[model samples]
Target: MITKKPTNKRLGEILRQANLVSSSQLEEALSEQSQTHNRIGDILVRRGWVKRETADFFATHWANLVNETEKPLKQPLGHYLKEAGLLDDEQINTIISEQDQGKLWVRLGASAALKGWLKQSTVDFFVEHLFPEQASDSPFTKAKSSQKTAKGRRSWFFSQMK
Candidate 1:
């Protein structure tokens, strides 16, 4: 009797969905893997597209999710930011309270940034790293991207004036 090997889910797809690897980066890694016959994770790491520890974390997260050994928590945005080390408990509480009081109408990360508790880049990093779906679906995210594009065009227009 022959027993077939159990196949694991695709790590590349998981990583891409997590926003750890862009489609272009994954494509490059796939191309390199085809040429070198190396594992995609190794190719990504070797090419400096992703850090080894990040790859390991996502791989482990996927394995745990697939094996039913662990269930991810659907926590509040403040909790997620606190867990990501981007916001302290006090800062999270402040943001939550402000939101509750109708004094703030932004997401947790944006609130933190607006309050000067965290840098915009720090919020962006944690949001991308920990909540890729939110990054893609968020209206705040869309506004931020549009703001960047407008800022770039305004700068170009001003630079041309000089």
Candidate 2:
């Protein structure tokens, strides 16, 4: 049996964190998987809790992304999120357009978070793991450190304007 990395979240956990499925639904699916001897992704897809592509992306491509250390990622964070079913083409286009209109340089992940399309933890996970080299340079990290209180939280780019 293939084992997942300790740092990597399971497919169900990822789906839950992304708010794609409810906890009760996941538990029910897990129960069915125990009796059906089927892949969790397949079970979820069959139940219509998740789209086929979304399940496939997590089952097939997620491991590759997590374990990819030899090759540097050429695509931006939005690409991965979209592939993972967390984002759609429209959202990606919107983010890109917004970035283009902004004067300051903001990471795509930061912009997504600002728009409430992604959670801070989710962005942090990708930046810290997938783009370790760029993590320190990320405005999210800088802002998180500087703003200890939630009310004071602001991206470095926005903070610079004041």
Candidate 3:
């Protein structure tokens, strides 16, 4: 008997389930993809229907959940957070500025928590939900919470004045 293991959901399905991209947006992107021979994510990004970070998140996690023969995507964390409605682009940009100005690099999840933009537990939930395969071994699992340290915080004044 040729038995087949269940296939993971497609990128569009994953993005929709996560509430990252609307059905119309996905359809449009898919249509564009058919004509351009480009990645749906790229098409969505180019069309400004979905942010690059959001597309990357779906592509990366989808790749992780699929069979090894498939290629994995290198996506950002912002998409998952955005899809979950824990954070938005403005918040992410602020966090990015902070990280860029900080003496030491800080993780996005930790920065969001420190800024009261998102709860650490919420970040954990999304991380576990999106990247089930890597959740147990990732830094998110080890930290147990956002990284809190004086050095980790960015100086708002320093960056603003510059």
Question: Could you tally the backbone clashes for each prediction?
Answer: 0, 0, 0
- Residue-level lDDT of model 3, residues 73-150, one tens digit each, is 233456557653457767876766755666325567767877787666655545555444445544423233334342
User: Scored by CA lDDT, what does every candidate get?
Assistant: 0.57, 0.67, 0.58
Candidate 1 regions exceeding 4 Å error are 1-8, 66-162
Q: Would you give me the overall lDDT of model 3?
A: 0.58
Q: List clashing residue pairs in candidate 1.
A: none
What TM-score do all the candidates reach, one by one? 0.42, 0.65, 0.42
Residues 75-155 of candidate 2: C-alpha lDDT, one tens digit per residue: 556667777766777776665555455543456678777879877677776666666666667563333423233222233
> Where does the lowest 10-residue lDDT sum fall in candidate 2?
145-154
Better structure of 1 and 2 per lDDT: 2
The TM-score leader among the candidates is 2
Query: By TM-score, how accurate is candidate 1?
Result: 0.42
Error of 1 at 22 (Å): 1.6
